[model samples]
Target chain A: MTGDAQTPALPLHLRAAILLRLLAIQGVWNYETMLGNGIAFAMEPALRRLPGGRQGEAYRTAMARHSGYFNAHPYLAAVAVGALIRAELDGVPAAQIDRFRTAAPGPLGSVGDRLIWAGWLPLCSSLALLAYGLGAGPLAVVLLFLLTYNFVHLGLRIWGLHAGWTQGLRVAQALANPLLRQGPAHVARATALVAGVALPVAAHALIGPGRVLLGSVLAAVAAGATLVTLLHGRFEGWRLATLALATFVLYTMVR
Target chain B: MGGDILFYVPLAVLGAVLGLDVVSFPQAMISRPIVASTLAGGLIGQPVRGLTMGVLLEFFALESLPFGASRYPEWGSAAVVGGSLFAAIPDGSAGAMSVAAFAALVTASIGSSSMVFLRRWNAIWARGQQRRIARGSGSAVVALQLAGLSADLIRGGVLTLVALVVFSPLNRAIVGTFSMSPVISRAVVVAVASAVGLAAIWKVVRTTAGARWWLAAGVGAGFIIAGTL
Candidate 1:
């Protein structure tokens, strides 16, 4: 609320710099601070605008404070960076900024994880796989995934930056906006639908219909395994697949 | 051997870039198994083979969430190794897919461990510069970030090269000696992968209201399409 409506937006070049730095925001991720260092790295460019510049007391205090432990999904972290920059420029108190910083990561992390990681990513990936399963060329499938996924990826980054800046200390209003609130549920539903279409198509592709009986047996086995996994708790598919293949390899070796 | 060296060196470099994409930079998800493996396969003029390997690997990769600092398989470089190993085979030999998958899974484990090491190393570097960082030293922060990126690049390159060198010949040997029928061996791999992928998707689908109905409709539509095909 302290952010002045009269405060001009950051210079385009500085905003560009922060956006570029955000790309590598997880570069130095660690247990103690998670993405804290990366956040500082992304924020540094914008902090250069503080009263004394990088050499100024204001800049130093903001840099050191922002460098402390913080974690959020990489893409949405742009919102946090944008808001923090706005806060610094508006001269928000360090203690209040600290409170916002601590509170921001949990929502950002959860929302981004659910939306991007679980929903949109799988949906696009399934669509691409579905295309490939139906006999699309490899280049086509790859292009489909990259183009579709990045469309949202780039858009979200740009939107987060703009939203966080304009909202500034009142950025929670941005988080509460309908897009963030309702987007995840809708995307998750679409993901489910796409995944269902993909599964049988991919199976049919891999197991040609020429051997109807064999394909049926394999399909049944897959279904059973899927059912068992669903009934059980967490889906550790990678680990299970690894073990199954490793055992198969060993059997071949022994024989 | 010379021919392999020529192929693997470039593949290793590609792995480095894609692996870095997993976390360090522009996470366009090109690091996904489907793309990474296909690229590896393209390197040897066997893009379809790479695609096949990639599809199976992609199924397993779907289970990974890549949440904040969570330990998950580094699929990018590992997929490159798997796809290259599978493509290297002269023919669609029995057990070839299985061996390549096994190699990929193992390499993913290695990549996973290497990531942990890189994080620790990054921590050490950051901790050493903590005083400067707390003092608001921009130069020190930049140095740490650059150093972290470089180390991750190196980790990915070395991991890919080592996996290729060790698994390539081993893969050939296993494929050559394997006695399982081609149909059955391939069926097992395909079955496990699809099942895992389906189940992983179902987990998410079941949680959201109305999603299950959408899924059922999609499945029915898929079968109708398959039937016509």
Candidate 2:
């Protein structure tokens, strides 16, 4: 609190470089380690204040936490890092980052946990499978997948970092602020939107043209109808089950 | 074992890369399932299958955001396993894809737990080397980083190899049993696909009520597009 306000902050390029390197401390090569590393990074400052006062304790803590976080939520960890780096650069105070580290975990974790684990992963992978079933090359599939995922991920990173540095946590707080009032629905919706776009793109690319298209169309209709019915409270587990059975039967007969 | 080695080597490499990326490198592009799995699938000469696996894996991976030392699954390795396994199977074998997906799912579950152990190990390693590291020696840093990456590589490689070895024969047996009945085979595929869908829906349903619609939209759109094609 006593430090000069005008103390030469880390240069933008240097900050970015440091951020990038810090991010690489564990690397995003895998989810488990990534979470551990991310958590470690997020908690680096706090770890520095711990009893040992070791020289590289912060980095080690960051690395460990990175693995921890990655294990729990790989995709969301990418976004959280985006937000964390932003908060750091903005000089919103290390305490704020700590608060976010504490507050954001459970809620965001819940939203992220459910969306990725239960919803998007299965859906997108299934579509990719459907495409493979149609015979697309591996390069094309990989390329497309990379393009779509990075589009969102890199975009979030850049956006989060920029906002955190320029607007500070005030901006991030504002963006995430609604969560406090609106609950987890907002995150769920955001996740759905992103996953929604991703799923069809992969499916369309994979399925190509043929009866596969027909089957997909029928499936879409049923899913849409089921969603609407559920929204209206008219959808029961039995009804949904029946719809699934019928869809399978129709697909079988037609194919 | 020949194909198994080929399959697992890439997965191990991917695990190493992703494990590094999680905290070591901020490349911010490769670790994603879409990219990782597709690459794996391509390496195996089945990009489409890899991509499909990536998409599904992406959903499951959506929640991963490393805020603190909390354990999460390594989708990068998991995707490689899922994609390669699915791609290895003959095209149009939905049943095979399902089994592969299940295999990957199980691997990821176990991987999540192993990550926790690695974290504690890393902490201990760091604490042990504190004095040397503080004195400007880079050995501790290098050792810690290497330890994480090496462990990940071993984990991914071993998991992929074992899962493929175990599941491939099981899949063959299952398919062989149902070979005569296209209905059963196709049914199995649909059932697996639905399970995947249900998993996704369950995630959406648990959080925001609104996500159910989005989930439906994605599924519906996918279904339509696939149908039209």
Candidate 3:
């Protein structure tokens, strides 16, 4: 045990500095991926076209630089930075940090990107929209969006960097799996519930008394019927459209 | 006009918070269009308009997720700018909101480039600190952290200032080009807003039937709420 080398701990300031550097890196990377010609998009296609030989290996190595796994999530990169800085400050060798940087980005970026962008973001934003439609104030809507989005983003980044790839992958997988499978279904159910509630609520909130409440009650009943019709598979796109049109006409005539 | 500075402070703060959300700070909810634009709108005195702007921005922002070193537009900042402008202007003109939204979109594009520059700057700073950091110097560590914060603050503040000044006058000019028609203006707003909602739903629909329900509910709810308000 005495003969084994000890790992170095990074100082607090160093960790902060490195985290900032990582943020810069993630931000620039994200911008480039979006505005540039998207080398990552082309990599898979180009890889399939390559003949098997030394040329393929060389192509593979070059492709590694633009690899989807490495370039994907920007948020998780912060965790890697934190980990590296911590390692360095604690007397862990610079080489170890370098190795971790090289290895961590690919896996974490791949998983984190898919989880945050493809899964959580869409889900949360959809919910926020639902709330907004229900007459939630702009402040409430925005605050909820920020609260949900940042918690996931920053939490993952910090955890990934500190706990390393394994923990990050586990966390991402837990959340993302549910999203990929049932997120859409849940969104739909929630949306219907909100719609049913909102029509009446909005009428009450915006329009005062009498006819407004009557109109809202009628609309709510109609919405409930539509949901049931939809669930029963009796309502196709055209039918739903017709129903909406009829509702609009009825609402107009009544008002 | 001196009172205008108060308006600008919140706008600047919004920019800073959103910019931080993009990379430096907690990645939580700040980037969402609903959150960012509404906050901007509230700061400017029109919450409903802000919410509307936020929804449109959110739709357009569907494609943006910070992955790696890619050059993506900063949607959070862009939405704030767009939302604030739209909310501030009266409801009778399409051109004002259109110009402001377009300006914000363009500003986001430029912001992507600025992010790239900042990255390179960070890399240079890191390289310079390699030896000192390797030697475990505490002073070098503090300097680097301070540098990053200062850079971010300046980046956000400057971007917001430039966008507000340039787009405000541009919005007025654009609005002046045509007689303001309330019906036509509202029509334009509704069209843009609907398109955004539709686009977002389209993406969600590809995943599950639930998205369709959500979409229908969202649209119906929005209309009802807007009508009531």
Q: i-RMS values of the candidates, in order?
A: 1.8, 8.6, 11.8
Displacement of residue B121 (Cα, Å) in model 3 is 2.8
lDDT of 3 by residue, B7-100 (tens): 5667877887787666644456575666777778888778888877776566456545555555667766777787888787876453544555
Q: What shift in Å separates residue B224 of candidate 1 from its native position after superposition?
A: 2.3
Return the TM-score for each candidate structure: 0.95, 0.59, 0.60
Model with the higher DockQ, candidate 2 or 3: 2
Model 1 lDDT tens row, A114-223: 88998999998889889987899889988998999999998888888887888786777788878788888999899888878887777667665324645564565467
For model 3, state the Cα shift of residue A63 in Å: 29
Rank by lDDT, highest first.
Answer: 1, 3, 2
Q: Which 10-residue window in model 3 chain B sums to the lowest lDDT?
A: B186-195
Which candidate leads in DockQ?
1
Tens-digit lDDT string for candidate 2 (B135-227): 433344455556655665565556555666665676565544433233343333333333333444444455566676876686566545544
Which pairs of residues collide in candidate 1?
A: none
User: Which tens-of-lDDT digit does each residue in A134-236 have in candidate 3?
Assistant: 6677777767776776676666655655543223222234334554345436544553444333333432332222333444444444454345344433322
lDDT per model vs. reference:
0.84, 0.50, 0.52
TM-scores of chain A across candidates: 0.92, 0.43, 0.44
